[model samples]
Target: MTMAYKNVIHGLQKDEGTKENLFALVFEQGMSTNAASIKLAIPRSTAYSWVKKEKEQRSAAIEASEIARQTAQAAAAENLKVNLFALVFEQGMSTNAAAFGLGIPPSTAYSWINKEKERRDFTGEASSKTAREISKEDLKENLFAMVFDQGLSTNASAIQLGMPPSTAYNWIKKEKERRDITGEASSKTAQEISKDDLKKNLFALVFEQGMSTNASAIQLGMPPSTAYNWINQERERQSVTAEVTKETVQETVKETLKDNAEETVHETAREISKETSVETSVETSVESEEASTKDADSVYRVTFKL
Candidate 1:
């Protein structure tokens, strides 16, 4: 036998000192531990412990007598505190509460409860089935996966999952923009937003061409306000249109000056024609006077000569 067993056996040995101590007591005469405990000043617990040591020779015998009796009595209990299911249905205990009382695994208890529900369903006992609640984390993960992996539209996902289309779109848009609650851009948003080819094309057509927001919206099949917002956002990116408004203004001014110069030339030509006509009239008058004077002089000379 092991050392512990030997020690226990040794402790059970009858001892003269214990007997004498018991005899000195008022009650401990010939009686066993229980009777001696009643009569003697020594404690009944001490007396019983002594007897237990003495009875070590009959180890199995003592155990078979009291321990077995108690064990059997406990086993004979009729109700025996039913398991989680019975407690839940018959005693109205919650699954969690029942699980706690029974020391069974909570998951197991919950499974049992669910099984009970399924049974009720099969039997047409329960009126309706409740949908399992979705958590925020679950929604975030699913939305991310749907957008990235499945290539599903946000509105489509919302329709499928019975969520608000706007909410789904907002989540996707926010993630694409990388605008975190902290006002910082996340890498995921930057990547997703960049991947939107439609957005890129739309911005190019709108801001680059100076296309009106409504026209751009019609082309892109989006709201005008949305197109306007995207045009503003395009400005944040590299310059959409290379030629500035200053260059256009300068070109327009140059054309205007050229037109004005041509009109001025036409007016100057008309004034020159009018001045030429007046000069011709003065020359003709002078010519006529000179001719008459010449004729008179000639006549006078002829008379003198004669």
Candidate 2:
């Protein structure tokens, strides 16, 4: 057609084709070197070289590209995974809780949780440092209602809640200690911790500051009857303590008195015995002015023994 050709064989065009002649059989027919070579009656090596040249030229057109975007995306994913791990395992938060905090799906969080479980089981490592904070609500509401409001023992509360009694006890003990250490800075308000806490405060105001029960109740935002009852209990407790102290003092005094009297008697007897043990001799010499029969003398011996 254009008469511009790349290669020729005798009088036929090699890179050009007509109805009676064909060229570039390997590419035009989409044939492999083996098939094209046999079809075109050419050596297999010649067909292979043509295919190789095209492959090299096409490959040469491609250039290397920077992958910073992809690297940053991968790093962000890794960081998310690390944060999820810390919240779920290290902080003792549940999968759903950690997921909610991270704004991730709960299903994804649970999947990661299972994967971590398996990894830790295989590796024999533990990540948790404390019990879950979510359980504090159990202590504040459920356990408090059962033990204080319903008059159930701690063990009974545990049974009702389907947890180990020791777990409940430890949680309560630690919570109380935490509250004691932090005071007003505790996670819960004082009344939320226990209504009795408010009652005790009311009683303290009444007894310590001599405020009336009505005034204390009003100040503490409690019912007057409840405040009065708590104040009465506190007074009764103090009365019992006073009675015990008085009895103890009386018994101590009696013992001391009896022991001192016995000791005084024993000491007096010892001193008297010691004084009597020494010798007391009285000798008198007088010239005999009147003696019976001029050589007769009378002598009397006086002796006192203790």
Candidate 3:
């Protein structure tokens, strides 16, 4: 009957879903061919063919939309809000309020709180260091502790101690082999490789393989500096990793403590009778304590050779 009907007859001679959708939004809705063309952003001829098909299959589109809506609603109820502060500050609710609303746990809320604190304190790496002569054994022990125990990389430790990248790389490479052969747990060894093999492998991965030092450290399961050193040495562009300051670390810790305090405040507030507002303020007054320059535990970065 129309030019549009001719186009639809030719175009959807194949696909059914497009035919059904066109039918539902046009013929069943009693929409004019011009209106359907604008609504579906298609030529009027295609709308006529869809309208003809929709007249034949009216029930299916209604059923599909109903199913989709129900599935979406169910997913929304079950989804956990992993970012607590966003659930709180952005949503204008407290941690307890957000957790209850989102169907998530209190511990998840606390983890997000600490994560937020770490994010806040992550200023670009800048620290002050005092160099001290550490014995080779002690250095080996520290390196082992950093890599294996602490899961840090060499550049991270070098940044903390303010040492040359080459110095950290050389020491770890020497110690890893000695520990492996002696069957001691002090240094981490490469699987089935000599000292020369270790250096060559490290160089190839850093330079030719083109992996970043941190990524190489994770792949090699060693420290960051070891990987960084090999790459730097091969390229002849030795760049020192900037340090993160004690002050920055302390600030991060303080923010964490503050979040803990807020959680405690929230827990206490939740216990008070909700039927009637009972304003009870419990203040924890601790006297001023001396601030120390050092961290509670020493943090070292380990470098991994690829």
Q: Write the per-residue lDDT of candidate 1 for residues 191-296, one digit (tens) a residue.
A: 3564376577676776688777788767865556656776777675545343556677789999999989998999899899899989999899899889989998
lDDT of 3: 0.58
- Predicted structure with the largest TM-score when compared to the true one: 2
Q: Write the per-residue lDDT of candidate 3 for residues 1-306, one digit (tens) a residue.
A: 799998897665644655555666655786677786787677777777766655556567878888999899667633543444555444334455556556677677657656655665475211222121223345556665665455456656544443445666777676677766787754443322343455666666766888667876677655666667666675554232223455677889999999999999988777765423433221111111212212322222222321
Error of 2 at 28 (Å): 99
Question: Would you list the rank order by TM-score, best first?
Answer: 2, 1, 3
How many Å off is the CA of 158 in candidate 2?
25
Candidate 1 stretches with Cα past 4 Å from truth are 1-244, 294-306
List ranges where model 2 is wrong by over 4 Å: 1-200, 279-306
Q: What is the TM-score of each candidate against the true structure?
A: 0.29, 0.30, 0.20
Clashing pairs in 2: none
Q: Per-residue lDDT tens digits of candidate 2, residues 193-259?
A: 5665665677678778888999987786555666677788888999999999999999999999999
